[model samples]
Target chain A: MSTRLDFFIDRMVSQRACLDFGIAQTADMQGPVFELGLGNGRTYHHMQHNIKGRDLYVFERAVASHPDSTPPEELTILGDVRETLPAALTRFGATASLIHADLGGHNRAKNDAFAQLISPLVEPLLAVGGLMVSSDRMYFEALTEMPLPPEAVEGRCFIYRRDS
Target chain B: MSTRLDFFIDRMVSQRACLDFGIAQTADMQGPVFELGLGNGRTYHHMQHNIKGRDLYVFERAVASHPDSTPPEELTILGDVRETLPAALTRFGATASLIHADLGGHNRAKNDAFAQLISPLVEPLLAVGGLMVSSDRMYFEALTEMPLPPEAVEGRCFIYRRDS
Candidate 1:
């Protein structure tokens, strides 16, 4: 059995690999990027460096990341994701080029349940050809599950593409 | 410290993630793909499914893979990679969009030595913007080491891109 450290490393590495691939695939696309959770803002900061000429919107209940990694307030949508995500769809339309989420807690069952709850809220925001990279398996009606890029662990990270 | 199984799984997953990323990056480039080792032809088979409109050349000493995974004689360049790789540089010039090598044995020191030996030869064959994905760290003159995508274990799988 893998240790807790191994699992954490797997989650982190998979997150990086999949997110990088998603960024590259959507490089030519014309849409903003979305971060569903802003805990620590590590992923958002990484995206800011690699992604050029796009608006990066962050959805979170509050700002608590390190000062260097924090998103600007103008781009921050502060509230519970369930409320904020739907509001985002109305404000932005189905125009997100990439939507990333790592919103689950430590408990496996609870995380899975949370994934089910937010999957639909997250689904319509993706533009066709955009990608949804998540730390948990998401249930989407239109977004197709894409094969994970090479070093990403099977269950640790997921990529779903809106093809239509 | 991770167990042996953890290491093996990390290597396998990293290889897949990097290869897939390399393929996507080079999808618009014009050149053939090269697979340096054909052991079991598993990686080669995976590439075959995802890569379209590109010739794939396999470098191997002899055919030992499962019949289902074996490449045809026309695409298989039989001989030690040490010799065949250089010969390929002469025949194909610096035009490979993606060159993947996993040519290492079980010994760590020996693999490191092998990577050093082949790095120079592998360095010249990649087209600018092409990517070289290897299981061992390479010593290259002009190729730039790229940050591994998320979920790819550091030091397990490496990707080098020819930037200029």
Candidate 2:
């Protein structure tokens, strides 16, 4: 595995506090969840373990090297979030109730592109009171530049609630 | 503010990615850094700001409210982790090259009593030839369990090279 990939995995394993925090925040919300930048399907598995019977769509930039080896039934892997997010949305025929993305630290251009792609889909994908929880690092950067208040950019995860 | 304190402050504001990934892991090494439990100070500051300095220590218990006026510089407040941590460490003559504690989720007994209070004093905090870098959620949790395989952890933050 690449160093970046290994680092990401190690982080997920060691930092259970943050992961559990994010999971708890969105546990009670409804689902038909979408995970962007699904690295090695770990977070996807975490969500499965926590919230069962929820449909899951995971978008990754690359196809898993071992597809069909251990396919998760609930997870549908879409290659290249930039290219596949819109198509996956269309296939699902609905906007995601919870869109979890962690692509914000290193790749500025890719992160920005993903943010823009998902921004327009937020309202439509979320159900009434549905949420879009994204990593603070990626979303906060986009949020700070926009004219939002400080309260708007605090947590590592951002929750977008749909009213209607 | 002292330059060391200033360095931490700048980290909290500008380099959150580094703070969350890089500095947080330092506490996890089998040295002086260990996880602390949930408390009031963590809610408002430590976790949010990612502040770490020699003079910093967080209380494992909650305080109902903040004092009407700040205490003298020499006197350490128990509840205000942001202020008290630095004070306590300095007063105790304790020093840490790295400190990592995520006092936000799942306050367990062991983490508070054993890990937090004692871990900070481990000599030669970083493992020889160990590197400090940011990581993802999965790997972060994996480190908690003992007997970590040699291959699982890599990356160098600040190399610990002793003069030959």
Candidate 3:
């Protein structure tokens, strides 16, 4: 029970950080909202509702979310994010203002490895001063750690800004 | 000690809620950020750095916060918030997109009454779809409760959106 509560809190805090990034910073930056995970589509839907008028381009392996939650055709990137993200940059241009990386799994080792794998690929696409809001901390050259807001518990939500 | 911890968690959850509101909704809206309290300038500083290029207007009884953290002369509204908020809005115009109400004293009854006192004066100034991120749950007719993001412990933070 306690573990479940912790999971809920962690996701809640991290997701809030994502929203704050959009309002506080992404509002000024030009580009569509991007996400690496479309699981359940909860986060994607939340972003759409909160950031009205922003386009969301997502990379997913399959149509995992409820049909109602899926992004429209042309917005969804089918296949593994590791390969699709680079292809996406070529198509969309490196203009993502906000990127929410929600890639994590029940296995910690795998999740950690996956984050490392994609960090390099994702780095170049973020526009200057764009935000990378993630579930886990991913280090990339030129990205600076933005302080977590007061409501965020340490280690729960990781936020970084591309300063350059 | 436990009481202090609870207070911290509550504030943290609410602050996360505030950020969620901004990202999810306020980023698309127009207007400057407004604050009802300026204690220590911690929250103010957090907002400025995270939100990026947004002007912050603050109301305080006296000058407080670190010298470096203070908002500029034009942005800081001195004297009581109930008075300062209205006059400042007259100058700044009724276009505040994000309003952070942090008025909290140890006394619950006084805080409740103070919330009531300030609600009417603050409401009209919020642009439609602007956010009212407060320490307490202030019920206004036009405001709707945005679901608290996952990390937020229920009742710890209160968030309301100006739907109209």
Candidate 4:
């Protein structure tokens, strides 16, 4: 990851740390997770080891770091999610229940485009009870002010269920 | 439920509608869902009949409208969220799993404060696997330009997860 990406990931990790603390406080860990845009296999390795048998799918644009490090059988690295996502899903014969996208950074247009691109995949991929996590900063600069008592904004994740 | 509050709820409802179509793509339904800042109750009336159990909570600085019409059992009116959220939770006896907040518009300071207030409550209030959804426009004004391609952002989400 580049310095900029590294900084973005560091921020995300901090939020994840908050989530880990919160989830630990609540102790609710039921996830069939899917991570979009896996880079260098660092997060995948952590989740794979942490969530054990949770079924992980890693879609990356380019494979650079730790390609060989990931468990070959469980880890799937695709060249481009835009093209490979559909085929990968067909080949794997499964859609993800939990889809995490941290693809948005300095590029707003690309971020929005990527969001629109993968949104279609989410409905088919996410399980009925699955959740999609992303940072709120990726979508907007600040939370709306009119609705007093604002909601969670940092590391905002959108959880969509097929039914509900 | 003053005019101001009604306007706020209208915006929130519209945003939720967008999420249903553009994002979640789920059929809207009636349920015992909670609305955090139930303004004039106009929005509640619009949605109450459609939702199976319509529970409205208002923490306005002033008096709410149509208190007589508000189903006493389902409706709650508080002076302020900071003072009343914990009490409201205790009174309601169930933490809201799916929360909606359009923390934007006129009251920027109030809205930001509200967001801060509710941030800690999300993990505790949300059902073990429940989701919290909000508009992206609330966070980012526009996407930033990055050195990497659009696809790079996707990988970042996963990579960030690991690095964090």
Runs of candidate 1 with Cα error greater than 4 angstroms are B1-164
| Per-model DockQ | 0.02, 0.02, 0.01, 0.01
- Candidate 3 per-residue C-alpha lDDT over B1-164 given as tens digits, one digit per residue, 9 for 90 to 100: 22232345456656755665564567766588887788767666666655645677888898777654688888888898778877877877768888888888656778878888888788777887787887776757677777777766666566777766
Q: What is the lDDT of residue A49 in candidate 4?
A: 51
lDDT of 4 by residue, B72-163 (tens): 54355545555565665666544443444433334457656655665554324333223334321222112121122222222111100000
Model 3 chain B worst lDDT window (10 residues): B1-10
lDDT for model 4 comes to: 0.43
Query: Given the true complex, what DockQ would model 1 score?
Result: 0.02
By lDDT, the better pick of 1 and 3 is 1
Model 1, B1-164: lDDT tens digits are: 34333465578778878987899999998799999999877788778777899999999987787565688889999999899989999999999999999888767899999999999999999998999999999999999999988868899999999999
Candidate 3 off by > 4 Å: B1-164
Error of 1 at B115 (Å): 37
Question: Residue A14, candidate 3: how far off, in angstroms?
Answer: 3.0
Of the candidates shown, which would achieve the greatest lDDT relative to the real structure?
Answer: 1
lDDT of 2 at A85: 61
> When superposed on Cα atoms, how far off is each prediction in RMSD?
15.9, 17.5, 18.7, 22.5
Q: Identify the runs in model 2 with alpha carbons over 4 angstroms from their true place.
A: A1-31, A64-74, A108-110, A136-155, B1-164
Model 3 C-alpha lDDT per residue in residues A1-164, reported as the tens digit of each score: 22232344456655665556654677866687787888877677667666656678888888777554688988888899888988978977778888988888656688888888899888888888788888877968778987877767677678877777
Best by DockQ: 2
Stretches of candidate 4 off by over 4 Å are: A1-10, A13-32, A66-74, A88-95, A136-159, A162-164, B1-164
Model 1 lDDT, residue B62, Cα: 77
CA lDDT for candidate 3: 0.74
